[model samples]
Target: MVRGACTLTAERADTDRVLDALPGLWQGFSATLIRDCRLRFRRRSELANPLIFFALVVTLFPLGLAPDSTLLSGIAPGLLWVAALLAVLLSLDGLFRDDFDDGTLEQLLLAPQPAGVLVLAKIVAHWLTTGLPLALASPLLGIMLSLPGHSMGILMSTLLLGSATLSLVGAIGAALTVGLRRGGVLLSLLILPLYTPVLIFGAGTVRLAVEGAPLAPWLALMGAMLALSLLAAPWAAAAALKLSLDG
Candidate 1:
């Protein structure tokens, strides 16, 4: 009876500890998210780089191809997706680099809250600044690419879902390379293969929409990917950040 009572007491204590930590975890996450967003905003050039790249890629594609609306429309899904993917990649190299250089990253690792929570906050901030804008701006680019008006909604929706996964997966690569002097090239190499699945599902979903096919299955698959990334990516990125710091 004494032993059983002790086990129950310990379980209660553990539960209490988790409950107490919840508030701190939320505070840390919100602070980190707000701070990162503000910093990115202050750096206007950096903030605009991905959007500019996204637009430039879509704009140039038409000039290089024949002035054929049908052909452009046919290829629009893939073209828009590729532009967004590259835009995300372009922004990723600097995800953690500024913090690492300024020593804030080390402080973040040493903070009382779980590193994964803090890292997830940064990832959220990244998506807000980079991926969210890309999704919002995609319809204009879609029109330029001669994508059918009917598919514009799907294009934006797919990008909204897919880009979050990209940011999560890219954070792992960013954390791993945060300490390198020249990690951009290596970052791309590390994450591009991981990016393939998102690219496929994102482009395919839009393509299916353009073709007047059912979108449920493709959207379901993309949601699964996003869910898995949400569950796994932050912890993976936290571990990678530790490895980078230790090395």
Candidate 2:
């Protein structure tokens, strides 16, 4: 009788321990996420400067490509949107690179919070820095691209949703290649193929607007892509970070 009682007691204690730890774990994860976000915004000066470079790149397109209003109008949406995507990619490395450089990433791996949460926190920061700015700037660039005023809402909406996915998906490549000396090219090579679907859906949504097609299908695809990437990319990035750290 005593033996059975003790056995039940041990199991209950174990269950209690697990239940107690859940809140602490959640708190730690939340703190990590909030910290990354706070740090990112605090360095807005450094981060916001990337928009300037993106704007300059967009301006150069008209000069380099045909200056014909009709041609520019036809291709402007695609070119400007693609340029924004490329600009976000250009800045993805800065997401994890600084933490890795300063050995903070290693410490994060050692934290009580799961590595996946840490990865997610960083991705959130990247989205705030790169994706949010691009979304806000898309309207101005949309005008530059000769996108009709009627399509501004669609262009901005698509860019906002699509770029969030871009930041998340691109972070996996950035995290995977972060410690490598020559990772820039490799990161692009690894991520661009993955980014293609997002680019297609994003541009497709805007193009649909230009042609007066239904917005539902493209928006659905973009939402699905964003949801999937948000759900899965963190796990992949976390696994990659573990591998990199282990090596």
Candidate 3:
């Protein structure tokens, strides 16, 4: 009886420690996110480039292809997804490049907090500065492309989910190529293939929305991808960062 009672007490103490760790972990994560966000947005031109690139790519589709609404609407979903993916990819090369150049990334790896948490925070910052803005700006491009009005919501939704997934996936590529002088091309080559599934379902979501079909399945797939990527991407990215640091 005494042994069982002691065991219960030990379990309770372990539970208490786990509960206590949650708040401290959250504080650390939030602080890192805020710091990275401030650093990223401090320069206006650099911050605006991705959003601009997204818009330009979308805009060019209308001019390059026929201006007819029927044809444009048919292709808009894929066009937008492809453009957003490229924009996200463009921003990724710089994810750890600057930090590596100046040794800040090394500092982050050495910090007491887990490197996975740090990588997750950086990914969040990347999504906020680059991905979120692209999603917000997408509706304007959608309208310009003559995309069906009803599809606008789904377009934004997919970009939000899809872009977050892209940022997470791209970070892994970024971490791996961060030490290279010509890392941009290598990052794109490594990440573009991994990006294919998200691109397919993301464009499919908007296409279904435009056709007035049920959206649950595509959105479900996207949500599942997001969940799985959320669990896996940061840890993979952190490991890549450690490898880069080793050399």
Candidate 4:
């Protein structure tokens, strides 16, 4: 009986320690995020593809549409947002492919920390790689597109928020398709409809800027969408990942 009591106490102690550690478990975010960034940066082609795609789309639009600043300026907000959206979509297919291939994805799912938090960190790292660069590169593209110089801040701001939301939304689709051999095409199809509203508000925000109109309402909506995606996407992604694992 004494030995049984001692064993029960030890088990209780182990459970208590795990519960105590839960508070600090979110630090896993930093570790996973850093690791993701390091791995992505090591692959130069993967890191550069979306940025190149973004720039190419922006550069081609004015030539294709005629070089008139009036025409270009009118379409610039939608053009920029569309290009950035496609760039992110292009990158989304590979978001989980590497980890899924090498088995790190399995480890992540089984980790002591919540899988949702880990997935969120990874999505953030992806945005830092694919989305943030697009946002930063937009001002130069804004110039080429003949967007009003005064609205350059609006261009950058909208892309920053919109692209992060895209990354989060894209992660859910990527998780759903990660196990497939040719998921890229299907991934785009799955996520693009969901991406439409973000494109609308994002482009609208910049258009308001170009028109010298109040941007607060549009910007506020984009911010709300980002907040909603941040809160909900990780959990949805984790559930999708579990389904992938089960399959």
Candidate 5:
């Protein structure tokens, strides 16, 4: 009985520590995100390049898939949105790689703040850099893909909501794989399967509209996913970074 009581006490203490750390962790995460954004945008041209590349990738699909506007319009939302997802995935590696390579990641771990907050901040920076652009540029790509103007709004909304979740989930995989010399491929390997659910719902939201079906359930699921990832991914990411540091 005493041993059980002691175990419960220890668990409660750990939980209390995690709870106590939340606010500072959140602040530290936000600060790191801002710093990363500033550093990334210092090269304005480089920062804009992802948008251009996303546009280019979307344009290539119509040419490669079909020049038929009818077919393109039917498939536009899925293609363009999924393309945006892939663009973010392609760029996710850079989120932690630079920090890891230059030792900024180590400082992040050693900071007075909890690592979870630090991870959250990195993810916030990542969303700002990769996900936000994808959301903003999605409409243009939507048009290129022959998506109807009405559907374009939905496309933008879903991408904005969905990409936030993507960055969080991707960050965990990025942290786990960061220490590996050849991590880029491995990161994708670990993360892509995890990303499919978001892609399904993100693309499904538009598909439902295209087919004249109710969108509430799909969008709700997307929101649920975002909430789940937002609530959970930071801690997992922090743990992965700790492991990486220890190794």
Candidate 6:
């Protein structure tokens, strides 16, 4: 009976320690998030590159194809998704390059908080700077593609959710290649295949919305994918970062 009581007391003590650490962990996360955002914003041109690429690809598609509104509308879903995917890819090569160059990444790994938490903060920052802008600008691009007015909301919604997953998944590739001199091509090779499902479901959701079909299933799938990525990608990326740095 005495031993049982002692065990319970120890468990409660550990629980209290964890509860005490929660606020500090949250502050670390927020500070990292804010710092990343401010640093990215400082480089105004780099911050705009993905958005520019996204717009240019969407704009040029109409020029190369027949100017039929129905045809443009038909292809818009896939085109937007592919373009957005590539744009995200283009920005990913530099995700960890700056940190690695300046030795900040090594410090991040040594911090008291888990590396995954800091990496997840960076991923969120990437989405805020890159993916969020793409989702917001999609409506104008959708109009250019002659997409149905009602379907624009769906396009934005899918991009918002899909892009978060992209940032998470892409971070793994970025972490893996951060030590490479020229890992851009290698990064694309590593992550492009992984991106196929996101492309399919994201575009499919928009297509269904255009067709006036029920899109709840597609959105649900996207949410599931985002949830999985949220849970797993940060830890995977953190491990990769450790490997890259150690090697």
> Which regions of candidate 3 deviate over 4 angstroms?
1-23
lDDT of 3 at 129: 95
Whose lDDT is higher: candidate 2's or candidate 3's? 3
Worst 10 residues of 1 by lDDT: 16-25
* TM-scores of the candidates in the order shown: 0.90, 0.87, 0.89, 0.91, 0.86, 0.91
- Report the lDDT tens digits of candidate 2 across residue range 1-247: 9999999998988788576455466676677778887887788787776688779888998899777778877886788678888898889878788888889889988887777877887787678778888888888987877778899889889988999999889989988898788889999999999999888888878888988888998898899999999899998998888777776
Best by lDDT: 6
The candidate that achieves the highest TM-score relative to the unseen native structure: 4
Candidate 1 TM-score versus the reference: 0.90
Candidate rank order under lDDT: 6, 1, 4, 3, 2, 5
lDDT of 3 by residue, 160-203 (tens): 99999999999999999998888999999999999999999999
lDDT by residue (tens digit), candidate 5, 136-244: 8888877766677777778888999999999999999988988888888998899999999998889889877777788888888999999999889999998998898
Candidate 3 to truth, TM: 0.89
Models sorted by TM-score, best on top: 4, 6, 1, 3, 2, 5
What would the per-residue lDDT of candidate 4 be over residues 26-140, giving only the tens digit for each residue?
Answer: 6788999999999998998879999999999888877687989899989999999999999999999889988999999999998888999999999999999999999999999
lDDT of 6: 0.95
- C-alpha local distance difference test of each model: 0.93, 0.84, 0.92, 0.92, 0.83, 0.95
- RMSD each, Å: 7.6, 6.4, 8.2, 4.4, 9.0, 7.7
lDDT tens per residue, model 6, 1-247: 9999999998988798577555477788999999999999999999999999999999898899888999999999999999999999999999899999999999988888888999999999999999999999999999999999999999999999999999999999999999999899999999999999999999999999999999998899999999999999999999999999988
Q: Any runs in candidate 1 off by more than 4 Å, and if so which? A: 1-23
lDDT of 6 at 178: 93
